[model samples]
Target: MTNSISITKIRQLMTMISLILLTLSITSIAVRGFNWGLDFTGGVVADIQTKPDVTQVLLKSHLDSALSQDVQVTAAGNEGNWQLRFNDTDLDLREALNRALLPIDSNFQVTNSSVIGPQVGLEMVEQGGLAILACFVLTLLYLSYRFEWRLALGSIAALVYDILIVLGLFAVTHIEFNLTVLAALLAVMGYSLNDSIIISDRIREVFRAKPDGETDSLLDKSIVSTLSRTLVTSGTTLVTVSALWLLGGSALEGFAIALCVGILSGTWSSISIGTLLPRCVGLEPNHYKPEETESLQSMP
Candidate 1:
């Protein structure tokens, strides 16, 4: 068998790859945009109960044909429960939905129905954008206060990297970008921030303790010291998120997907970008060295 690559080489390779992927993610978002859901575009939302045998695909296909329009279908909390979204501009949504399900389940019931106007959708879009911007601004301020500028910037870069990659996945797949998915994005920022802070803290400690050590060696040592904690945390998180994705129903599928991607990306960024960016920007042990007081300097 061939020998495995060293951790040093691996870090170098991953850093290069991360930068390239980050560029592609930005490009994809710019060019393709997102598949905005009814939450942002304004449409009818209906929760219905159908025959137990009715699947999302079957229901969607029939609705598409009967209503003569596109319909978005997702499984809700329980079997036979589904949420449907579609434009209601020129349709009697309740009547159309009831008639469409007649053949599949005569007893089918429309449990709830609501219409989201274009103006409301626009307002939600604005509010969601502002919330994310606000989060970034707050995160930067906190990180800057806690760490040196290089480390602070590194953590922010990792957050951006993780977010862009997740957004790019949604854009490329044309997944519906809804409020639930937006909530997941905010969760991702928090997770990424926590991971970055842990790794950065360890690096700072190691740097101060081994002021004479080589940068690469000190970084490797610091990361290795925290490797087990990172793996366990990430592994447990992936397990929970995997269950959520598999069993949480379609209403939460986007949310679960976002968390899964965010966890993995956050873990990788914590180890790679968080450390690499600082080193690239000339981070040195002196930055973490204790400052001398005027009295001590004068006496010395």
Candidate 2:
């Protein structure tokens, strides 16, 4: 009993610490503009594999001298491989940098290098924003039809908050928001809403089951009853997502992390906010009568 209490106390403290850290991160990001990536801002990626002993600063120095333009170099992979992120949309600059850096190392080998054009990058940003917006609007319409308008509104609010929090995480972390990250964010929208809908359906059933239940109490009961299932489902999801996060490689890491965070938040809001919509509209779940559904029909 003592150990369990101690662990719980420790966990509570840890959670408080984490929230404080996140607050600090957001404040810092607000002070400093976002750390935009090459994908959104447009630039060239120069990935090179060289002799095992080559250093990034040396590579930067050599390339910087030869190209007559500045560049930021990131060392990736095992000791020999490196990735250079440069601020330019020039194919010629890419080729020149590759050619110049190759000779510096006895076994200098260019693995992959390319310039991402600004126009294409801008188009991707535009399309991604539109896709998210369209998904949100369409989901609202679908839930309104399948459930009730109030339910739809509640679920969408959670969805919007989930997405914003995810973006806020990204912004605060200063992670690279490439196209892959956008796809992950888009995926969160559907995944989050699906969880919300499940709870919404349950709330409707709860309202139906207890015809004389007060609306608030009924919602509370519905959420409390569904709590176990939500935790179990989210736990299972976290297992797989955590596995992916641990082993998904750099390509999928950002997306996986975003999904993991959003899923947990989605589950939380489904119980807390999603079920409270009817209560906010002055419906008492525990006191609900069978005609309560009809009452909602005339609510708007």
Candidate 3:
């Protein structure tokens, strides 16, 4: 116990860190804005396999000349594989792209094409927002039912912190926000909540075992005890996600990046924000104490 680190001792510092991150994230979102993808912005995406001579710059120039509008061209996977994204989805536009590309590489072929309409894009935006809101509400209800209101609220606070940090990085880096990224956010919520629940449960158990112990001391011990498991879990996840981000190509880049950010943020918030927020909200030993003890105390 003497050797254990006192996490509670630095609660104020952790809170300050969280507030700074939150402020930076919100401010960046306000200033830079999300780089919305075709999934949310009504556009066309085409995957083409070009000849060895084809390059992103050359393909982009050809498509730009043909379409008469700006288009994004990116390397897809192995050499000569490219992806083209445009706001226009007209049939003539598609034909024109093929014609223009033929001059560069007559054998170049469109491997895949997708078009998202304005209405569909709007619907996706609304549905994605609703999905995130639903996750938050459901998480609150479950945590409250399983433990207590304070624990539930703390978990939610940590979740918000994790999300904001991830989104903030996205804003600052200008990473594309798409359906895959949104899915990663949901996964982060679940991952962070699991860590929060484990820590909260340990704290409750500690309080029950030593009812006379200082809440701060109990919290510190609980955090220290579970520190190993948290690190192991987070480490393995980071490794896997890091590998995915490094090799998964542009298709999964946003998803992998979001997951990477989410995992790091979640781990930090679960330890700092999740545990401390409960104390700030007046959580006490009596909240988890037995009925007999409570009744005995009330006998006065």
Candidate 4:
């Protein structure tokens, strides 16, 4: 009895915390919005090879002085290979590059230069939004088909919870919202859904195994049973993502950060929202039982 009460209390606390996070996420998105990156907004990108002695800071400083607007410089892949991005569409990139870079490298060369028009950016925004919407719809359909209505809804709620929290992290931090971060969001959805399904399956199994068990006690047992699996999966993924964040360079920084946040939030939502919502909606063992087949009355 004590254990059951404690578990119930923990669930309530976690639910409250999740609600606070969700509310904050929505509010931040509404007020602050996202920090759209060059990929989402029209901009100029140039790949250049700099002298061995030219560092990113040195190049950025020189470009900042030469160009009329701000320029962002990030290392591309190999040594002395750098990419530059700026929103000054009217500024002459070739002239600016020549003026600033020639003084330093003398042999610096511009390998590629391209412009992303506003129309293309807008189209990308529309398509990315549609992709996320489609993913949610498909997930909802699959979950509803695979489980009871209550469980399916709970799983969906958990997924939404994970996404909002991850998005909120980006919003609050003002991190660059680019294509890579968008990809991370989609990956988060898949990871969170997998975790939720595993817990839901365990819940159903526990309910069937002990039909008369108390709801809180049974749910507690189910969560406890899968806790190790969740930890191992999340832990290993985080390790790899952390490596990417540390060594993958500026290009992949946003992607790695998004994944890290998503993984942590996904784990939390799966353990709390995924299981608690179903219980709150009155999920019971009877919901999983086969329909009773009535015996035909004996002919009198």
Best by lDDT: 4
Better-scoring candidate (lDDT), 2 or 3: 3
- The residue-by-residue lDDT of candidate 2 on 1-300, one tens digit each, is 454345334434543544454466556557754556677788888777888777777888888877776666766868888887767665485467656676776566668878777887788889989999899889988998887677778898778767766777777777767777788888888878878877888878887787675555555556667778888888998899899989876557788888899888788656655655444665544333456576786886
What lDDT is reached at residue 11 by model 1?
75
Q: Write the per-residue lDDT of candidate 1 for residues 158-199, one digit (tens) a residue.
A: 998999989988888878899999999999999999999988
> Please, what is the TM-score per model?
0.89, 0.72, 0.87, 0.93
Worst 10 residues of 4 by lDDT: 291-300
lDDT of 1 at 143: 92
At residue 21, give the lDDT of candidate 2.
47
On TM-score, the leading prediction is 4
Across 107-222, the per-residue lDDT of candidate 4 in tens digits comes to: 88899999998888888899989998999999999998988888899899999998899888888999889999999999999999999999999988888777677788888988
- Model 1 misplaced stretches (Cα beyond 4 Å): 1-6, 49-58, 74-82, 292-300
Global Cα lDDT for candidate 4: 0.88
* Decreasing TM-score order of the candidates: 4, 1, 3, 2
lDDT, residue 257, model 4: 96
Per-residue lDDT over 93-120 for candidate 3, one digit per residue giving the tens place of the 0 to 100 score: 5577767887888888788988889899
Off by over 4 Å in 2: 1-33, 46-85, 90-113, 284-300
- Checking candidate 1 for backbone clashes, the offending pairs are none
Worst 10 residues of 1 by lDDT: 1-10
